[model samples]
Target: MNKIVYTLLIFLIFNHNFYATNYYVSNNGNDNNVGTIDSPFKTIQKAADIMSSGDICYIREGIYREEVIVSTNNLTFKNYQDEKVIISGADLITNWLPSDIGSNIFEASFTGAETQFSMLFVNNKRQKMARWPNNETDEMMMPEDVKTGYEDCQVFNTRSGKNGRRVKFPNLSGFPVDHFKGGIFRGIVGKKWINPMGIIESSNDTELTVTAISDDWGTNSSKMFTDNGKGFGFIFHLNALDQPGEWFEENGKIYFMPPVGKDPNDMVISAKNRKLAFVLNNRTNIKVDGINIHAASIAMKNTNNCEITNGSVQYLWPFFTRKGYAVSKTEQGGIFIDGNENLFKNMYIAHSWGHGIFIDGGRKNKIENCFIDNIGWIAQFTSSIQNFGDGTIVTKSTLGSSGRFHIRTNNKIDITYNDLYDCMKMGQDAGSIQSTNGGNWGVPLDLKGAEIAYNRIHDCNTLTDGNKEFVLALYLEGCFNYTVHHNLIYNFKTDVVPDGTFVYLGPRMATIKDCYYYNNTVWNVDWGLRVWNRENRGDVENILFWNNIIDGKANDGETSDNDRNVNSLLAKLSFKTNIRNITGNGNALFVDANQGDFRLQTNSVAIDGGTEVSGITDGFNGNAPDVGAIEYGSSFPDVGSNIDPEDISFELISDSSTLSTNSSDLKKESIVVYPNPSNSLIKITNLSNNYIEKISWKLTNLNGRELFTGKALTIDISSLPVGVYFLTVNKTKTFKVIKN
Candidate 1:
């Protein structure tokens, strides 16, 4: 007995470091089993190779195409209870057939050869890749000039009865035109935000040379004109695969159509060759719940206190070649958090070609009550949440059709109380809440303590094509101390470029100074608080556009010289010259600018009017502080209001309910609405005396469309259409009515 075998090997290594087990993965288990819960274990990287830092893996339900790389830290990958895991990266084609020249097409044969499928799926939806004015009225234009420098070559003509890029039309139409060389051509350049994509290199039928692999027709090659021929097209091969859920591939052969009644050998295709499907590198106190993260790309590199709640990252496509025209493309979409106190709650990131959450650098990160939609159409910095991080927080979220709201060079960030609407849609001059502050690794960083409060930013810039495409709902450029308060920016549409805006600050070359725009509220805008700068960059300083209520137009001077303000409004611009100590006192007088309420009624005239500026209106009500940003009696700040300050304290607070109140502190006698812009009767009283018997209403217009819902006290907008409408009462107070 060699001393009883050295005390039995130190008691089996202290019982394997004091037990902490619970690992069971499946997909018909078998990685040699033994991961308990009834012998499970079959990939999840073999239960992350025997998990350790406070282990706890469950995974059960089916489909686990795999690609998880985690380094390990308080790991806890859940999903054993309500089952339905699904962590795919694609791969399940099921030998298809029938295809010798269409009948509704159908084929599928790939030898793998290193995998390169652009994405396809059947029994789980998602297909459409083959494009080209395929219905929605076949849209197509652009007849003249589009011949680019030849530095890499590019040429596009079309328009003139179409059927050119190889022609076939009449009925379901055609376009195999000899597979048009190499294929790609996406169109819509010159700052309509972005659509760039050219590749063919040569093709007859109506011009289409293409070859410019890089810039693709953006970065402002003089706005790269195509005029306004709208969203031109042409994606994969197989003659743009004539309609019906489209699909196409070439070489490795794929071609599809099915959707008319489905059949392709009883569905279930799936084809996203994996770019990512889970790879939390640096690792930390991890916790990923609910799970449904399909088709890859979900990184969190230098990760810290990680946490991704509820979960859902559908069809995430990550593989960008050049979606930028001005800058912002490190390749992100469907989660790409760099690291720090992370927490992405109630998540739901959809369709992505780029950006639905891409935070570089990182500090106190937090993207709450999340829900990011369609997201960036090909690029232009793309965003549903793009924070350069410092003390980040994007709250009560609901972002729509993305691409605008980039926010570079960070400091103390907190973009609060959300409900951001439609958005830039595809890139133009930009702004659905865009921010910039010089730079860093490249030098320039300027912005400090920031806070864009109480949001409700409405139907935003839909690619306004005035000076050739520009839009803003709140686009701040340059730098400095901040506090742009109590927002409720309304319906912004100028159609063919009347030049949109509801707040556009300047310093394009970079350098905006100290700020404080109090009590904000702007309506159907075409321009309402613009501050330009252009030549040599750096003249807009010490600003303070106080107590606000601008019914569009408050511009502080200076136009032309690459900053154009053509055919102007706000009644022929006149807020003084080259601008300096900016100051616009106590504003109010937008009493029902025809239903789009900028709140201040009560015989209006902007109530107390305003002129108090001490720590910026240190809580004023009557005879003094009432020009704008809401103080006709208070109730509109949002989320524990105090004009927002939980720790980015730039200091100073005399407390008028934390500067112009409104975090559900409702007053001004609760709720009441009368003729207030009526052309056909309107009335909605509820003075909070509490007798309330079913409120709920909605009357949207200005392109948010709802036209009218029920549960009213009196409603009848004489068969609608007078422009500018929105009533939303019970969905949580929204008023501004005037059918006149």
Candidate 2:
């Protein structure tokens, strides 16, 4: 079917509404029973078949153990009561016998199809598929040891010596060599960012070969090298199941080593078979709340005004093809939604091998106060949140210690007040919050009016071997008409180099024009801001970077146009080529940063040093506007929300925790500066005697320019010009010292 015609047909069908009704389902009821609170239907599918428009299906507390297929419009599916409504795809396994191949190993035959599963769970935890180097290490085998080719689909050479289909490194060697003839090989071939799984077709002591499991990697990884690149190899076979908790599968037979002396019959082993939980097509005005969706994915397409709140979708590995090939599961994840005005709030999404929540195309959709973590452990997955729609808001949420939160080819998006960290664990060249132009898809898209503000983004792109892939806290490539303000971007560390920075603007083949970077605080970062201009596309022009507090370097490329910037804290603002009306001033400031606080002190020079930005700096406390994210006299601006990301309660909780209390917390009397707006000299007092004994002080202006450095509490500023200034008493404390 044609895509455009199909989309139009779905839109027309979803435009109408009908009468509403409520139905119920339970585990104890039979399929033939009428769906009611007292007499509920047994199967979820049976209730879904008869559901009409605006109908509500309440699933009672119990494990339904079936894949729900939704074919109705404006229908709601939720838990009938406060008890758990677990919709699971995996079935419990119990039959077991001792393995004849090994002493402690056990075998179990499954009644389900042989191709039903490649992953297994014991006690609700994913079991290891038997890999070597038992512990993950920073060092992988060098690239020179291995060579890849697609023709053999099965032929390759490894310098590491352990060959054929099984890996027998010097530190690790066992009976796994005999099982390599027909088993599968899953290895991290190069850079550890991509894993290729293949079936063994032929093997020897030093030579091995297999067909590629994933389509993303054809014959070999394009980035793989015979010398400089590196990766690890994993072997999963019954012979390699020497450790407890390890498992292997062949045909309909499964092998396990029941953790020490524990019997396999006494353990609960589950294997996921079905794929989807709720497959909604052209559905609208529905809500699925307080239900537990496990081991399955949900698909909602062409839907409007739908919500999935206070619920969870976890452990979803839709395609566990153990036949040794890469599974391209891009369109599948915990939740796949494409429509308008959808809300996914207060949800707990975790432990998925693929994306957590994928929003393809929608408008005014929100993913708020949700906890998204432990997603995309394998590099093949897309990760946390990938939204390719306009007017999407991901706010007041905590996202990712794994996978990247990315936005691509859309506009009018607001990503604010979220705590994002420990990202890009499996992939590279990205950040915790990243966006790019839609032009890469050969389509015209607008990025105008897009805002990325008040976000606490950190610890991005931390994975590396030897290559230099620049990562950022906020990465905007080929985007324009964007406003990035009041963000706290810091602590971007790399193992190889401090090459990545807080912000990376303008890609080599793209343009960044008319974008404003204002009032942001950046510290402990290599590059405060990096902007580039290339001759192939449009130049970086008309960028207004003002009132930012950066304690790092700034690099603007030669070919870029004028940057209308002022009140920045770097030593010098660099623009190699001179463009007309370029203004860079008041840029030397010293922020006495203690911990993560970048607030201006009472008498800091930056308090009122910045020139007024017409609409940007409207809410000021003093005569002139203050630089950086927080204004001195007014209430401190809050960077991230205080809502616990792991909070999954289904009640109405106030978001008042998002407010900041920095001023009250820092008003300690242990370190105090006296003399109100005085001239030249000032007196300092310390309630704590130990604080006065060994104290060092420094004074600086708001532009981050250091004016004084001494240990004495009494300092003479009378000789200097009268202005606003900040005085630091100790390394950990900052006090406002004014000079009249």
What's the residue-level lDDT of 261 in candidate 2? 63
Query: What C-alpha RMSD separates each model from the true structure?
Result: 29.1, 21.2
> How would you encode candidate 2's per-residue C-alpha lDDT over 1-740 as one tens digit per residue?
99999987887677634345678776656678777665667788998899887688876554566777777666778874454566767666667899897878888886552223456666455666544323222112222223210011122334332222223232333334334655566554443445556666554543445555543334343444322334455544555566777777766777887777666665557666667777776877777887777677677788888888877777765334332222233433557778899998887777765667777787888988887777765545355777777788888887766644433334567888787777766555566666666346222235668787877766565545455545678777666777888777666766675655776665445545667777776665655566543434434556766777665344433212344332231223322211112123312333345345556667766677666777767978888777777778554445333445344321111101111112243234344454435554565544323455677888898776998898886677777687787777666667666666
Per-residue lDDT of candidate 1, residues 163-229 (tens digit): 2322111122243344566766654444555555656655555455555443534232434545533
TM-score of each: 0.34, 0.71
Alpha carbon lDDT of each predicted model? 0.60, 0.60
Count of clashes, each model: 22, 27
| Model 1: lDDT to the true structure | 0.60
Worst 10 residues of 1 by lDDT: 650-659
Candidate 1 regions with alpha-carbon error over 4 angstroms: 1-25, 29-36, 39-86, 93-185, 189-202, 205-235, 238-252, 255-288, 296-374, 378-401, 404-425, 433-466, 474-517, 520-580, 583-740
lDDT of 2 at 604: 62
